[model samples]
Target chain A: MTATKEHVTIKGNKDGLVFLFNDHCEFPDLLSELQYKLEKSHQQILSGPTIDVHIKLGERELDVQQEEEIKKLVGHHGNLLIQSIESTPKEQIEKNIHQDLKIMNGIVRSGQSIHEDAPILFMGDVNPGGMISSNGDIYVMGALRGLAHAGKNGNKDAIIAASYMRPTQLRIANIVSRSPDESANEGAYMEFAYLDEDHMQVGKISELHKVRPVALQF
Target chain B: MGEAIVVTSGKGGVGKTTSSANIGTALAILGKKVCLVDTDIGLRNLDVVMGLENRIIYDLVDVIEENCRLAQALVKDKRFEELYFLPAAQTKDKDAVQPEDIKKIIESLKPDFDYIIIDCPAGIEGGFRNAVAGADRAIVVSTPEISSVRDADRVIGLLEGANIKNPKLIINRVRPNMMKSGDMMDIDEVCAILAIDLLGVVPDDQQVIKSGNIGEPTVMNPTSNAAVAYRNIARRILGDSVPLMNLDGKKGVFNKLKKIMGIG
Candidate 1:
């Protein structure tokens, strides 16, 4: 007896695999199948050390529940890879992007221009010359050295989050922010960006509600 | 060991493929086995620039993806015994290949050649990663324009982060007259900002376009100004201290005309 080996269309990327198949499969069934196969080879090394991945959905469409299911299976703060979106409609694609999370992976090279309008989650290092524009909250799970702009749509309530934040230039909408000087480039903690009554400021995510001095110590 | 050097410029229309073809042909003339691998995938132009597209039986994707054997994928140059062309797949995009897959392919070629020159595709995406993955060294090809230089600077950081350390630079399409008159940014300023070692400077030469149309690398045309620059870079690659080609003076009549019109 032959098992129905699903006609999985594998779209390869720099970091990992993007499996495009039917949305009819149950969430548990899909997750189990992926786990059964991936864990066989990845059992030795599949946690942490997030690898950036992109899912380019050019033709196929995915439901909201399936998207959420996939996200749950991948787990938060895990190795990130972009999934199919080109195939999905623009609004759906925008809605599917992690609004509260910034997804960036790989080294952001100089002159490499990047503009994302979603709440961003980056898994890679932001090198010197790159720039990102996002409307929602931006979170960096890695080092950010390039010019990054959060709340580009003039949302005064937005914040920029990073695991390592030493931006050459930071902007939250019209408000301009600068790095803490070349000598003060050590950022080992997660930082967040928000607007004050008249000034746009960034503070540690843990201390978002807490009040501190006008000028940050960092 | 024969080194694989990927000539990349992330921004499109910046002559990445043109520079790769010229440099590969130049290296072969120096008696080194050279293979130019076009990793541009779906938007390949190296074969067309080299005038070898019609002769291609397979491509770089076919060899690595196991659609064909390496020997079958390699298209030998008509005139040079040491030169070969590995074209890209016109049907597939950057996603068809990966960095690891490219590394595996280059590792296999280590024992057989003196140089594996990859023509990197535009963008910092999959094609870019695959091209640079197997490269022992990289030559970022860029114009004198600020945008190109800026992108080149970013590419340098990318290469460094990937541990391809100390990638040499090739500044192409330099119009010395423009720099002399302050119309264009001089190479010195570009070098100062990027702080990378210089490989060689190629002057603007119309023969480069004509040569491409004829399926020939400018370097093969001995008298072409740009060819002299590519030849100089090839020599520099082999540890030879050849002088850089000057912008205005070369054997080409077209080059001379450009000097008269102050266009080059």
Candidate 2:
């Protein structure tokens, strides 16, 4: 080997060890260098408690198999733990803002229908014969006496919540459920409808945080 | 110019004609020049209800077609002071007159009367549209029954879509005994569902059917509960702050007596 090139540089910060791989070098050369560096530091890593290691690929596009290979190589060192793998120049992703959350205010009376492709927050009563459907979650701040269909676009994770949970019918994705013949005294409590393993289930709004942690991202 | 009020109900037999005739008569009784226009062409009954069927030489279609002038078609109601009646043509259907024709007729009548009450035909069809064409205000009539209330709600939605905002609600034929027994929806329940301002609530009184049979409006009867309710509604239309009549007073007393007898 003509003077060994520094294809991988390891540094320690408050967060953990950072492995900055050189982009100009060949990917195989970079991976081998990273393995060598981690092995060399194996003794040094054992001296202390397990430390988090972060891998940073600068402008290097790695396939999923290559990334897994790198992760397995890093895992070979017992004391060295990989916390995260990131690319400096990430791929661009466009998020639609309108499909995130929509707010509306009014009484949806009989013969009126409201449809949306995104999550909706309605702040009024939905009388009998009125309908509200959405591709995502449906949140009503008032009495929901009419029909509400959530996850209409086949999003099974969608939910329906209301202050007064007396809906005539509730639909989520492919599941359909109707109100009981005698409306049970749900008692003015806030309630939500969600899909549980292909079955429609109704639960109190208080338990929504744990049931769907990702839905509480906002 | 005077205001043109459209009395409409989507379902038939919910007392749209009766409510229109009584409200118009009550307004006349209040010393206002009221003109009642029957827009239920081909199924005309306002004339018969108003007892002016014998005087209908010219009809709404005749006035719209320019065969007769507006004044020539208006039949004067000599019993009520300054009340006029315009009968619908029994031969011509609802399509005979367009919304513009009704607008023109109403505009002409607005200059001479304090109120131009248009009696809209049942259902949300061409006749209903024609009746509501030139109205400045709307009164949506509904009964306590579920079907009637549902139809009323649909009609209200249509009226709002037509840019007629804040249409007042009149709950007709409310049987207090049934409401007390939980068999019928109460006034508050109806109001909550409709979500509109309560113009008035008329109780279900046998006197109403009797008066209708005699071609006399229930408002003309001083002892009838519906007449008092209609009079109050008329007063409300005139911007008077009148309290709602005690709907439960008589029924509450009867309920108390029944409970004492262990018969309720």
Best by DockQ: 2
Over A97-208, each residue of candidate 2 has an lDDT whose tens digit, in order, gives 4436888989898899999877899999888899999988999999898899998989888899999888878999989998888633443559998999989998999999
Candidate 1 Cα misplacement greater than 4 A, ranges: A1-218, B248-264
User: Per-residue alpha-carbon lDDT of model 2 for B1-264, expressed as tens digits?
Assistant: 899999998999999999999999999999999999999999999988888889899999999899999999999999977999999999989999999999999999999999999999999999999999999999999999989988998999999988899999999999888999888988988888899999999998999899888889989998989999999999999999877776774567777787567565
lDDT of 1: 0.76
lDDT string, candidate 1, A1-218, tens digits: 13866433454566665666544555466567655544553444356566655554444566888667666655543665545334565666576543334456655667665667667677766655777668866667776767788778887666777888777788887899787665635555787777787486767767865743322211
| Docking quality tier of model 1 | acceptable
Best by lDDT: 2
Candidate 2 regions with alpha-carbon error over 4 angstroms: A1-99, A183-188, A216-218, B249-264
Q: Looking at model 1 chain A, which ten-residue stretch has the lowest summed lDDT?
A: A209-218
